[model samples]
Structure formats: C-alpha cells, structure tokens
Target: MSDHHIVFIPAAPHYLPTEQQVSSAKAALWQWIPEAEAIEAAVTEYVQFHDCGSNFEYVRCHVCGQELTIPQWHLLMEQDYDLERGFGLTPQTLPCCGNVASVNQLDYSFMQGFSRFSLTAINPRTGAVSAQQTELLQRQLDHPLLVIYCHV
Candidate 1:
C-alpha cells in the first residue's frame, strides 16, 4: 500500500521551536487539514535529513547548479553521518564546480531538507498546502518552513 505524508520543517536545520510554538503550529495544521489521519511532531537530538522518499529525484549544488549523482551524494552523507550525533551538515567541495556547499544546502528536486525538528501529517487527503496556510503555519511556529510531500 502506498502512503503520502505532508512534512513541515524549519528552514534552519538547527532550529527547534518551543513547545508552545509546536502546539500552535499543530493546531493550525489541524484546522487547515482536519481530515488528516495523524499529525506527528518531533524535536531530535541532532540534525537529520528528511527525505521525500520515492518522490526524490536528484540533488544539485545550490551555487553552481551541478547535479550531484546518488553515489556522490551518498559518499558525502556517509562522511558526515555520525552514529552518535547524526549528520554534521558541514560544507563540502562539489566535484563539479569546486564550490563548497552542505548537503542541507543542496537543491533537492522534491523539496527535501534537513532539520532538528519536524511536523508531519499522515495522508492529509488534501494535496499541497496553500500559500496562505503556509504563511499562517510559519507565523504559528515563528520560523520559515519547508513543505515536503513524500510518497511511499
């Protein structure tokens, strides 16, 4: 069975909203997509990549626009991943342009990102979020958010 998820993450990988902020955001999301199966919010100990699952395509350098192949991306991720601390999210030189960029800074084809905190809705029936709703959620969380749709 396939499943869909609507994920919202703060733009800053290290940002974690306060409990009140999270509750406000959750309330806003529930009001916006009341039919959703479930809403889950989490604040993690370290920055973690929130991928778009099967919706993922490719990642490219934000500065140079050079595509980073899956293998190259994997190598970079492996180098940065720490068993105890999670991803370092540090800058690495791109093989194509020699420009430095972090994995979190890459342009994901499917709107994926890295964050220490995330809010996700399971099967929100409603498709993409509207611009107005996005803005409202941002205000509730007091942080700019990245909306990601994941299919699995």
Candidate 2:
C-alpha cells in the first residue's frame, strides 16, 4: 500500500447515519476515494487508539495479513456532548467504522481537542513490525491538518 497520512478528522457518533444507512454510507465513502488503506481489524484498533493512543497505525495480527488503517482525530465530540459548541470545529466528515452515523461534508479546523494519535503499520500476518510500512505511515501521521490520505 502506498503511504497515506494519518490525519485527524472532525466527527462524532451523531454525524453518522443508522443501520439502514451503512450500505449507502460505505458506497459514498468509496466514491470519495480511499482516504487511507487498512483492514477491518486495523480500523477497529485505530478507533480504539483514538480513545487513548496506539503504538502503530496498522497492527499486524500474526494470523491475518490484512493491514489496518489508523484513525487519528482531535476535537472529539463525545456521544452526549453539545453539538453547537463544536459546530464549526471540523475539517471534514470522515467514514464512520460503525461508531459514527454518516459523512456528509468536509470541514477543516486548526484547533485541537480530545485525543491525538499516530498510525503505524502492524503485520497482522506475524504480529511483526514492518519497518518499511511504519516509515510510510509515519509520514502520513505527520500531516496533522490533512483532509485525507491517498488510499493505497
């Protein structure tokens, strides 16, 4: 996979749609272009990393050869947080991996909030570190203000 930056996004759970919206949402995202590339599990970890912080962008699972994408975001709006307070703080709407509702527009904000993280490559195939992949991911992580990473 080509290097895609791990940029922060502006979105909360509410911004997403419902179950009926999953197919449409994914389809819409596919059209937006692959912002980043990673497997489903990596996506899950990236989501979790946002809550605390992760060591890598895509974690290798030793058994699976899939590369997970790391999700790093700031100015996180909690489930019950007031929306108006963060009304104009987003840079854009990103694909929700189940936690979010839907992505609509792109908003770019200079302010930072909630959590910040870095996405690294994990080998899932051997739970080993891919130095090559890590370096590629590190570059993407450096661009904190990017709207999307080139989906490899």
Candidate 3:
C-alpha cells in the first residue's frame, strides 16, 4: 500500500524547534492538526523522504514546453538547494529549455525533501492538513512553517 506524508519544516533554519520545543509543538499538533500521529525530529541535516511506489515519469520545461526526462528534473532540483524555505527546489534556469521555472512550474507526480522535523499522520482520512491549520500551528509555535507533500 502507498502512503502519503505532509512534512512540515520551519521557515528559517534557526527557527527549527529544540527538543523541548518539539514537545510543545507535538502537543499543539495533536490538539490542532487533524490526524497528527507523531512529531519526529531529524537527526541529520535533511531527511530524504521518497514516494512509496509512484514512478516520476517526466517534467515539462516551463520555458519551451519541452517534456524533459526525470534526470533532467533532478538536475534542476540539485541546482536549487535551499531546503530551509520549505519547497527547496525553487525556480531556476531549466537546463532543458534554459528558462527560469519554479517547483510549482513543474508537473511532477511525486515529491521528496530533507527536513529538520516531520509531523506524520499515517494514511490520514483527510489527505493533508490545511494551510489555515498550518498557519495556526506556525503561530502557536512562533515559527513559520513550510509544508511538503510526500507519497510513500
């Protein structure tokens, strides 16, 4: 069976929660975020979360509408390496078409990322936590949050 995870990260690197803070955040998550199962702190710089079974076919070049291979997409992701801002792979020059494009520009079927913490809700009935709820959680924790979708 496939699984979907909505990983949450702090907007700033410095905003990453401390161990004690994680506890408080866990409480907030349980109280507010629907289907929140647990809050896990990352031991490494980034957590490599991947899709369970979906294969990434290809991504279209935002510039020339060219359909590029998955490896080409990975090249773009490698170029834009800022993960602290949530969606790490921001817009950059597409090697395939040489045009600036953001992650939102790519038509990708799956996503993965490195994060300092993850709030996992196993097979949540609601799919994902809402932006409003995340915003509220951010306020409660006094840290801006970035949410990324992962299927595994």
Top candidate on lDDT is 1
| Residue-level lDDT for 103 in candidate 1 | 82
List TM-score per model, in order. 0.97, 0.23, 0.57
Model 2: ten consecutive residues of lowest lDDT: 40-49
Question: Which lDDT tens digits does candidate 3 get at residues 1-152?
Answer: 67655566664433456676666666766665456454454534553333323544456765687787767776666665556643454567777767787654565454333445555544454556777888776775678766666565
TM-score winner between candidates 1 and 2: 1
| TM-score of candidate 1 on Cα atoms, chains taken together | 0.97
User: Model 2 over residues 1-152: C-alpha lDDT tens digits?
Assistant: 43333333323312322333333433433333344243221122122222212222433212233322333332233332344443333333333332332112212222122222222222222222234543433343332221223222
Point out where model 3 deviates above 4 Å: 12-15, 33-37, 46-68, 76-93, 97-114
What is the C-alpha local distance difference test score of candidate 2?
A: 0.29
By lDDT, the better pick of 1 and 2 is 1
Worst 10 residues of 3 by lDDT: 47-56
**Candidate 3 Cα deviation (angstroms), residue 12:** 4.3
**Candidate 3, residue 103: how far the Cα is off, in Å:** 8.0
lDDT of each: 0.91, 0.29, 0.58
lDDT, candidate 1, 1-152, per-residue tens: 88899999999999989999999989889998899999999989999989899999898988888788899999889888999999999888887788887888888989999999999999999989999999988998999999999998
What's the true lDDT of residue 45 in model 2?
A: 16
Q: After superposing candidate 1, which stretches have Cα over 4 Å from the reference?
A: none
